[model samples]
Target: MLKSEFAKTFAMLATGLSCVLMAQNTLADAPEHRIINLQAEATREVANDEMQATLYTELNEKDAATLANKINSIVNQAMNTAKSYPKVEIKTGGQNTYPVYNDKQQLVNWRGRAEVILNSQDFKQTSELIAKLQESMQLGNINFEVSAEQRNKVESELYIEASKAFQQRAKLLLAPWGASNYELVNLQLNANANRPMPIYAARDASFKADSIESQNIEAGNSEITVIANGSIQLK
Candidate 1:
């Protein structure tokens, strides 16, 4: 009877040990790890506040120096016109003079070209000035932009929002898995602005107007995008 009782007690202990070992092995094999990927976009419309346009003009002559001088004169006139508007800023650009080659590859004429960029914070005034000047000079291209200051502010706010979004997702995910919290492993971020394309036109056309038509300009909102990709340990 004593030996039988001792054997029964040993059997019970062995069974309990086996159960504990199995539970530990299950946990070790199915360790909880998670990865959450999320994206956030923020956009707001500000005024089409700024204007960017280029002036392209050319002069032709037999003498290279004469052609250059004529081109310079036209450039100066354009500058003077830009000065009339306090909001407009005219920046001198590259000037190029190349010899024209005929079928025989002989230099036939000297051509001079110059470009200038005009930037204005006031869209209405800039557009009006561009139309007026188009009659006297070549209209190269026009574009609209959001100020650097505005873009930076938007990006900063969006990044904060993205971080919060990531944390929220992690919390929700862990809660469903019967986990109390998650340990963040990594994080990364990025952002951009959408602007209008430049308008390009030929130099020969006159900007002079019996009636001037203003373009419907919209400075539409800049977009701030943030991508959150990382791993978390659930516990």
Candidate 2:
């Protein structure tokens, strides 16, 4: 009787151990939580608040020293004139001098070109300055852009809108599956701006310095976009 009882107890313990091992294996084989990926974007058009203009001058001289002096003179005069408009930002741009080669590949004369760039939030001032500079320098191009501060503010607002849109889409997608809750697995945000091409026009060197007119510029719209990408695990 003692031996029979001991055998029965051992059999019960073995059965319990086997059941525990099977439960563990089942848990291990079960698939991980499922997730759905989603993306949403928002765009806003805002008026450009900044202006940039590039003006350049070219000179051809038989002597290199004379060419450099002339270029420096013109650039200095332009810089001084720009200082009068305290609101405008001025900076010197590319200055290049290269030797002109004849058919025989011998260096003949030297040609030099210098550029000055101006930027400002005040469109009127910037345009007028460019017109004045045309007396000595040629107009390269004019560009309009949205200021950094304004762009940042607009992007911040769009980010919120895009995130909300993403969440709404996720909920709508999961509604049919009878899943009303989700866990955000990962998310990403991106911001971008669409800048228009620079405006080009014929050099207005014909206009007299005294009669130079201030240009009336229209600040076009810049389209700012923000996108949100994320994966959510439905609960």
Candidate 3:
């Protein structure tokens, strides 16, 4: 019985020693200094293809119902006016109502605001629609951005360029590292865009329908960027 126990203990110790030796050999074979991180970026200026604009009206009255009716009437008219431009998308939601207090802090009246938002890719149609709505509703703001389909198309092209740039850079770096070749350990790609909101040059909201005219607009451009981040093992 004692001999059997001694044999088992000796076998376990031998296995543990073998594992430690194998780990040490692996560490010796791996050159930690041979691995390097690399990054490459590509950018392009793309024309903005999408636009979003807001129009709203605010009114105050002693009666909440009357105030709501007036606000709703203005927004409804704006919505009806927008329907003429089928190419543009329209919606309404920014309805807000709050109490108004006089100097004595007494609830004297109610004030309410309603909004209509417009989204579209057809800049000309949207511009015309904005002109029509400005006759009744006040312009909140207008901004442009790259649409999803356009952004995806741009990103696909950028990735191709960014990947090639990374490879060229990696190949150029091999000589400095004293390596004739390298193997890609890992790779990652990312996309981003730099877009700034454009201000709308709006006139008085009370302008007559005939007085308001379609103004020329320039969406400008956005800078789209793609980056390639990776690690390479030199050989």
Clashes of each: 3, 0, 0
Of the two candidates 1 and 2, the one with more favorable TM-score, higher being better, is: 2
- Please give the ranking of all candidate structures by lDDT, highest first, separated by commas: 2, 3, 1
TM-score of each: 0.75, 0.85, 0.83
Residues 76-169, candidate 3: write the lDDT tens digits: 8888887789999999967899999989999999999888889999988887887788777788888899999999999999999999999998
Which portions of model 2 show Cα errors greater than 4 Å?
1-25, 28-32, 204-214
Go through the candidates in order and give the C-alpha RMSD of each one to the true structure: 6.9, 4.6, 4.6
User: Among these predicted structures, which one has the highest TM-score?
Assistant: 2
> Global CA lDDT of candidate 3, please?
0.87
lDDT tens digits, residues 118-199, model 2? Answer: 9999887787788788889998888899999999899999999999999888889777867868889999999998899998
Mind giving the per-residue lDDT tens digits that candidate 1 earns over 193-227? 56656656665443444334646655554444655
Full-model lDDT for every candidate: 0.74, 0.89, 0.87
Model 1 stretches astray by more than 4 angstroms: 1-39, 45-47, 202-210, 213-222
